[model samples]
Target: MTLLLAGVTLVSAFGSSFQYGYNVSVINSPAVFMQEFYNETYFDRNGIPMESSFQKLLWSLTVSMFPLGGFFGSLMVGPLVNKCGRKGTLLINNIFSIVPAILMGTSKVAKTFEVIILSRIIVGICAGLSSNVVPMYLGEMSPKNLRGAVGVVPQLFITIGILIAQILGLSNILGNLEGWPVLLGLTGIPAVVELLLLPFFPESPRYLLIQKGNEEQARQALKRLRGWDDVDDEIKEMCREDQSEKLDGRLSVFNLCTFQALRWQLISIIVMMMGQQLSGVNAIFYYTDEIFKSAGVNENNVQYVTVGIGAVNVFMTCVAVFIIESLGRRLLLLAGFGICCVSCAVLTMALNLQATVSWMQYLSIACVIAYIIGHAIGASPIPFVMITEMFLQSSRPAAFMVGGSVHWLSNFTVGLVFLYMVEGLGAYCFLVFCAICLVTFIYIFIIVPETKGKTFMEINQSMAKRNKVEIQMDKEKLNDFQTAAETPKKKEEAHSTSVL
Candidate 1:
């Protein structure tokens, strides 16, 4: 973590992840305004009023576009990161935000509600690409010893971004009808900032040496990134290790899909990422106002409470960044998911009892806060960091693709069905989440290795016992090949002796 490294990491986080948090919550405060705009457009087009159900459907589509865009964005991660390089892909990703921001900012004047939907889709793509790329870039750039803390940087900014969005959503700022578009358009600012600043930062050294075969440039980049001239050992280390494991080219998502060797690592990341999203964090954010209302907070003060929870999320993640390397990934994930499991159960009971027991409402609110804390401490940040350490440069993007797709898919599932779950099972919807948390925790506690300070290969080899045997087999084959090649020289010397 040199200053330049820290600065670029922050720049990436702000440009990409900040937009993600912003988009996720920016719609919340102005839900009414946007919905009204939707209805007005429909009425103007049809020359008649729209049905409530239909209006709701349109509004749902509008809100849903962000995650949907993210889904599509996830699918593109492998190819984009592979072809464009992490830094280059992210630079191009600004188009998704800047254009959408304009559309969203001027949606009122354009008199086309469709542009708003379009804006959501574009900005959603922005969030999606950023979410996947920033983590991988930061993780690749970070030194192994400081990797965990530095890797968590994007997530820390994400929490801060969410907090900032929540604060900005207040009516006194940008949540008002006239102000909503401005709020929605604000996502573009980070993109512009990132675009301008990112060119100055060096490309990932791993990408340069391992992927591009530009060893000299890789060495230069590493020196700049590490703030030292003597990066020779570092370059040589990666080159030597990768010489055996290098693929013909960057692996495709399709190849990753079929690759047998990486199956378990792939599964581990898929589960961890899915677990991160499905651990009920977003559902908690969605349920906050009702929870606060149930706890006797007035409607106006609900925003304040939501902001407080956002603050808690930011604060806890900040704490996590400091403690991640020391505590190690496994313990933190277990603690985080374990705390969330209990918190979700408590939340279910509290919600169910709120009608019968007056104090139960307050208890539910406390549970909500506890759950957010639990999520931030472990579940929120570790999965992203773990993805980086889990795969080498060749397979990292594909791993991210799988992870990102699962993440957004799970998140989208929650958004689409959470209300129905609440209606069908009431507070017990958390029971489903509680079950998810418990099973995920058990699997991770038992299976996932502590990737705290290990190199990519060390973590991979330790993850599955079978992988060690496979690697050893490869080494043996290489040794045999070298021996066979040397046998010719021995025969040539023997023939010379016979001639003599």
Candidate 2:
């Protein structure tokens, strides 16, 4: 049964990853193609000669729009997952993927930019929904012993999609103006397969028990997940946790705002996401062609180099999956951030020396590649897994929504502003990112806790205990109250209430 659950989870995850790759790779291969097509077809038809500035702006828009759609789409997933259940929400999202592929593929054959961009927005929405729901679902469904490992699947599949996109982008067979549409359209295939396959997977047991209040179904789901013939004891334990009044109000956004534990968890998630974005990894992935060109690589060979970036991303993420359970999250994060800081410093130096020697360009490429490798090993997987771990059953979905929103918002910002930064700030851009990485390393060291082998409730209780101690210490500082508390009757009442 464990194997079955893992299999189903992997398949569902793969569909989402495939869509991710398609969106990322479409731009990598077709960047030059689009520029040429715009000049020859769109611009010529409008009797306007292409300006480099306008072309760059259009290219930026084409890349940034997906993240914009993602921002809105991620916001929608919280309510939908709460209402429809994970399986149902995913099923609907799969349809979102399929429709855009058909429209974009057919429209591109007819040479319609309007159709292509429209399709991209729709696909972006689908990707956002998957990104929000898949990690939450995987985290909730797995056993505590395997949660971190299972949660890493989404990140793994994301890198896998990057690899697939990189390979597809590099393929000479599909490296043309028309091939861009076909490549973009091919993202729908996994969605189609998922729509056909995912119905058999069980609903998340935690969601079933906590949100739906269906104990019997939750038990059946847990039994299947655990491969146990009898799960009465486990069900009772789950019920005991559910009965605690502490869990009831935690899911409310109002409670999240007021409660110390929830507040800290939310802050941690936001910080982790912001760190991920500010690391400049997405900028590297989305604008690999531009980065390579700036390194003095020939314009025609940029897509192939972009493929190399993707390959490193995919390979390093695989390394992360193996080490995550053994070496642990904190170590990986520290090592990854340290490496990124060094790489960014080197990249800045390489850019400063670009006029002196051609070899500096090669050095810049190496630094960027090293930065990507570090990200794959640490920040990429850790933030996602940690966010999922930080909340209790009641608060997990809402926390995920908050974290995922920050993530996509940062992604949109990086994608939208990076081209402008490249043009205006030049090498100083790497310096800014390097500074952010330094701060992130410090934050992780001081605040983020070791979650290895801990259950959801255990982690929550540990955080709550920490909050309780701080609250007690703050209360003890009341001087006037302390004088009044010297009275035996008042002191007895206070002690009694505390004991109760």
Candidate 3:
């Protein structure tokens, strides 16, 4: 890949996708401080301390609001990318990040926990858009050969962001009462860097050519991205897909829901997104300290162990970035969920027996790390890449909206209910996640195809068999038309040869 391509990926991932991971884990370390702040604020306002149950309810809303905002942001994906273009949408999304960062930074001084909660929602919107748009932008800008690796960059950065947050949230750093607001506010810095650097990069060539019908502009962008002028084959692929989708124009979310041809593609994305979230990965991130504590780790040492878990997550996702192209999407997903399923069962056993068996606590910790490895390799990144691969340009944005909505909604459900699940089910909670992993593994093994080196059209063709549709007949018809157009020329050449 060209330096320019690498630069774009790094910048975009740092500014956009990083926030998703950072925010997910940042709250975990500062949970006690923030809840105390909330109670103190309430006491000052009402001349009495808040009740414990109400404080827990308020905290749940504070955490859950992020994903709730994410759902709203997902709804906006169809319209924003269709109108502003992917690069532009990403640029505009910085507003959501920067504004909230300021509010959150001053939330402590203002003595209003409400500002912090509101800021989470706004930042969540930023995460929502970035989580969808970054992959779409990267998928469109990258050459076909590099698409898988480049698409994984966002997930890699997300892991990095989580690690950074975990490190900063250490007691000596920002996890304490005085430093928590600054930790929350630091999410804006990447957004500022992106807004300054991203405009210099080109828009997605596919978006330019297919959506706007600007052939020369698309050619220029493609040449810049590819670092060569020979982008004709790529352009032709875009043109063919564009022509095929011309009648549909840009599909709206409503159209995606009702369209018969994309039924399986839609179902596939929804299932992947739901599985990605509901499989209990985010629950781990959100409640790592508690999980480790429950597993019998010393209270003082839990924060360090949590940071170690974040490091494992980053390392494994980095490993995935290198291996994704080689192993392909399907196999990695199967392996990831399979590992997670077994780890969940083992973790349950370990957590249950930790009091009875002294070494079982160590086993529980090992199981959690193994689960991170399983999730980081495939479950985290592949679904985002598949969303970009699974749909044609006209329907791609709408498909993202649908998939993203399912992703965030499932995330919201998990974040909201997981505390209660921990209370009610105890060691059995992970078994629920294990079942989700098992079902997801079976579904992927049966239904998902290898999308490692396929074009959007090629991927669609592969799905047609499972969808029970004749989508490839359009390509066959196009081929037949080209053959017919060439027949008369052949006849003329033959006659000249005979006359001579």
Candidate 4:
């Protein structure tokens, strides 16, 4: 039963990873194709070539639109996951993926830019749902010991998908204007697979116990997860935790206008996610061609080299999965941030000294690759993992929504502003990102807690300890209740003994 549950998790995690890859990779090689399609279909219709500024604007809009759609999808995911359960939520999201892929593919073949944008938006929404639910599901379902590693699986798979897309995009057979549709459409395959398989997987026992208040179902689910019938103690402990907290539906952001704990959690997650975006990973992913072009690479070969970037991302993510469990989350985050900061600084310096030596181009590429490696190891998995783990069952969905919203918003901002920054800020943009990384390192060092090998409830208790006043108050309240309840029983036992 344990093996069966593990297998289901692996399948779900891989599906989520595939979604990440499909959503990200579809745009990679299609930039040129998209630009050409837009120019021929729209610009030429007006009998004028689009200006460079407009071209850049159009490109940024197309890219940013997906993240914007993601923002809405993320907001929806929290409630849906709360009500529908993880498996149902993920399966439904696949429908979003399938429909968009079909629309985007059809639009590309038909040369309809409007349809393409709409399709991408739909796909983005689907990706957003997967993004929010996948981490939450994985974190909730995994063993306490294996949680970090299992959580990192989605990140690893995302990189794999990115690499696969990059390679496929570079294929002479598929790397053309016509091939863009096929690339966009391929995402549907994994979505379909996930939708079909998810129904067979068990819902999260913790979610069921806490959210739905179904102890019997939760125990049955736990039995499956632990592969044993002797789960009564475990189930009782879970129930104790669940019952300790009042089912105040007022836990949501909408109900509680001022929740200090929830506020801090949201801020921390937002800062972490924003830091990840401001680190400029997306700039590298989306504009590898332009970056290479600026560095004196042959424009024709930029597509192939971009594939190398994707490969590096995937490789580093795999390394992270191994080390995340061993070295721990905080350490990995610090290491990744440190590497990215140094790499970004070096890239800035290289660009600034471009007039002095030809080697600067190589140095710039190395720096970008280093940044990717750093991101794959650190920022990629940590934010998602931390956000999901930080909150209790009741507050988790809302926390995820806030985090996912910030992440997508930041991604949209970066995607929209990157081209302009490159053109206007020139080499200084790398310096900006370097500064962000340095700040992120400090923030994680001071604020983030190590959740390695800890259960979700344990982590919550640790976090509550940070605020001594609140902790003391809550403890006193709990102690008072226990004392009051036991006093009656003590009196009754003494009276019975006296009568004997």
Candidate 5:
């Protein structure tokens, strides 16, 4: 069972989640060069240099299109994953990557920037689908005890992908003018590998057993994946969910929103997803090049620093994979956000000091590095794993839909307005992110329940108990205050004094 789970996670991470990070960081190193091409192409086609703002707008479109495409791709996940199953959606998603790769590879030859933008959108869709599907598939396949660790594998690979893209985008490698297209085009390679290998893995046993009601096939798959024949306990748990889910046919986000039984589970998913993305993780990634420049790093060596930061991210996420189960999801989520909150404050201070102090550039660099480390360990991976843990088979896909949409949309929001925010808010741009992180930490500390070594039923019951306790405490406090107020004026004053 361990070997099988490890093997499946390894392949899925490389094929799917890897592409998400690749798409994200790939455009960074080649930015100036791509803009040059956009200029050259504009001059060739229109016989004049492109206007500066228009050129920036075009570059922004190229860079921002990935997240926009991600938004659309997120919207597609519910229908695709529901209709085709997790594995099938992944297989079909490769088409988006391959076709876009061809278009991007041929962009220079064709001398058209439109093709490259289109490819970005298509590749974005591919990444969006992969990002959502991989986690859910891993979650469904994981055994209860190893679920947290297994769920984090995709995020770990994503950091690896970012590191790889950074290395590939180096000037000596693929970051130069001639090498840019090939860099963009190679995004398809992982997809092709995934397409070939996906068939060798079994369908998600939970999907087959609960969604399809195929006891025999589910049993076989469970046996193959778990390396044991005794499956009564697993099946009984599925039966509990299946009986209710089947009658509902298929649950939608709309259904999840209104379902009283799942209120907190759904709230946890929403708040976690929102906190993860809105905490400014994506903004940090988008802003890295500028952060490096502001820190007075040379332009030539900036990519190296970027790559180094990515390496830290990968290293921290690897640590996260090993420790997530032990610390439990709630603690890590809180710790991750807490560290990031402080890092952001430090970042804001460093940015503010860069003008007054010669060494503050280094402080800014240190702050950004610290922020990335904080995020890689907790904010990046935990919510992704937790979202999968929050819901059952019936509502999992819908939950992912809501979660993925919030994630990509928040990413899109950051990518879209990041430059303007930096221009307008300057160093204080990060203060906003700092505030978001602080509020998110307090909210999670108060509302999100711990889910370590717990079953779904147990988690649900515990949440209910916690909420009830809070409510009763609130009522008791209110009654005590009222009694003090209702006492005779002089006697009430004496009573209040005594209570104080």
Candidate 6:
């Protein structure tokens, strides 16, 4: 990769995806302190101590609002990227981060827990935008040969962010009453760094060429990104895509869902994204301390153990980054979900028998770590990369909006429901995750194709069978459809009739 390309990937992922992981885990460390602050604030306000149930409700909102805000942010992707361009949208998104940092940093002094809750929503919006846009931006800027590796970088940074949060959350660090605000506000630093450094990098060449029709500018950007003089071949490849999609314009989410040609591509992303969240990885991340306590670890040592799992998560994700290109996306996914399925089943058994079998507690810890390994390898990173690969330029943004929505919605569902499942099913709650992982594994093994070393068009063509549509592989036959579609003078009418 060119220095410019590498720089872009690192900065973008750190600013955006990193924050997603940070906020997800940061809440865990400060929970007791924040809840104390909330109850104290309420007592001062009402001249009496707050009720436990209401305080619990407030805490639940604080944790859940991030994903809720993420859903709203996903809705904004289609319009923002279309109007601002990928780089421009990311630049503007820093506002979400900086604003929340200020709100959260000052919230303690203000003696209002509501500010922190609101800040979570705002930061969640930033996370949502970053999670969708960074991957889309990285996927577009990367060459096909390096795409899988480049795509995995965002996920790697996410794991790093999670680990950093875990470490800083230690009592010796920022996980205390005085330090919590600073811990919460630290998310803004990456955004500021990205804002300063990212402007120096070039925008996506495909965005410049395909979306804006700026051929010369696209050539310059591609040359800068590729660190080479010869870009005509890549430019021509983009031109063909632009021509193919000229009649389609940019697809709205409605068109994306309705279009028969992209059916499986849409379904694949939805299923993958849903599976990513619903596979219970976040449940493990969210409840790691509790799980360790149940497994007979001392209360004092559970935080250390949580940090260890976070470290293991970072290590496994790094392994995924190095190996993704060599191993291909499909095999990694199969292996990841397969590992998770077995791990979840084993964890359930261990949890059930831990009181009787002394060693079962150790086995439960192993299962949790193994499940993290399974998730990091394939399930976490591949869905975002696949969204970029599955659709052409015209539909990519809408696809992200849809995929990101399902991702966040499923995330919110897990955060909302997993606690209930624990209440109702006890150890058997993990069996639900096992079932999810198994079904997702079967679906991927049977349906999803390996996208290594292929162009966007090639990937789409390969999906035709599962989508149950005939792809016109010949250039002339494709042009004939474009011609018939463009025959009418009204462009909107032409798109409506032709793309259908």
Name the best candidate (by lDDT). 6
Query: In candidate 4, what are the lDDT values of residues 459-492, reduced to their tens digit?
Result: 7677765633132224444444334334534634
Q: What does candidate 1's lDDT look like per residue over 247-270, in tens digits?
A: 334567778777767777787888
Q: What lDDT does each candidate get? A: 0.83, 0.74, 0.86, 0.76, 0.81, 0.88
The clash count for each model shown is 0, 0, 0, 0, 0, 0
lDDT of 3: 0.86
Q: In angstroms, what RMSD does candidate 4 have relative to the true structure? A: 5.8
TM-scores, in order shown?
0.93, 0.86, 0.93, 0.88, 0.90, 0.94
Candidate 2: tens digits of C-alpha lDDT, residues 10-48? 887887755765686566666788667656656646777
Q: Deviation in angstroms for 40 in model 1?
A: 2.3
User: Model 5, 66-152: lDDT tens per residue?
Assistant: 988887888888898878988899999999999998999889999999998888999999888888999999888888788888888
Q: Name the 10 consecutive residues with the lowest summed lDDT in model 3.
A: 491-500
By TM-score, is 4 or 5 better? 5
Estimate candidate 5's alpha-carbon lDDT, on a 0 to 1 scale. Answer: 0.81
Regions more than 4 Å wrong, model 3: 290-296, 472-500
lDDT of 6 by residue, 285-340 (tens): 76677678977789999889888898888899899888988999999999999999
Name the regions of candidate 4 deviating beyond 4 angstroms.
39-58, 109-111, 247-250, 255-257, 290-298, 469-500
List RMSD in Å for every model shown: 6.0, 8.8, 5.5, 5.8, 13.4, 5.1
TM-score-superior candidate, 2 or 6: 6
Better of 2 and 3 by lDDT: 3
Please report how far candidate 5 places residue 233 from its true position, in Å: 1.6
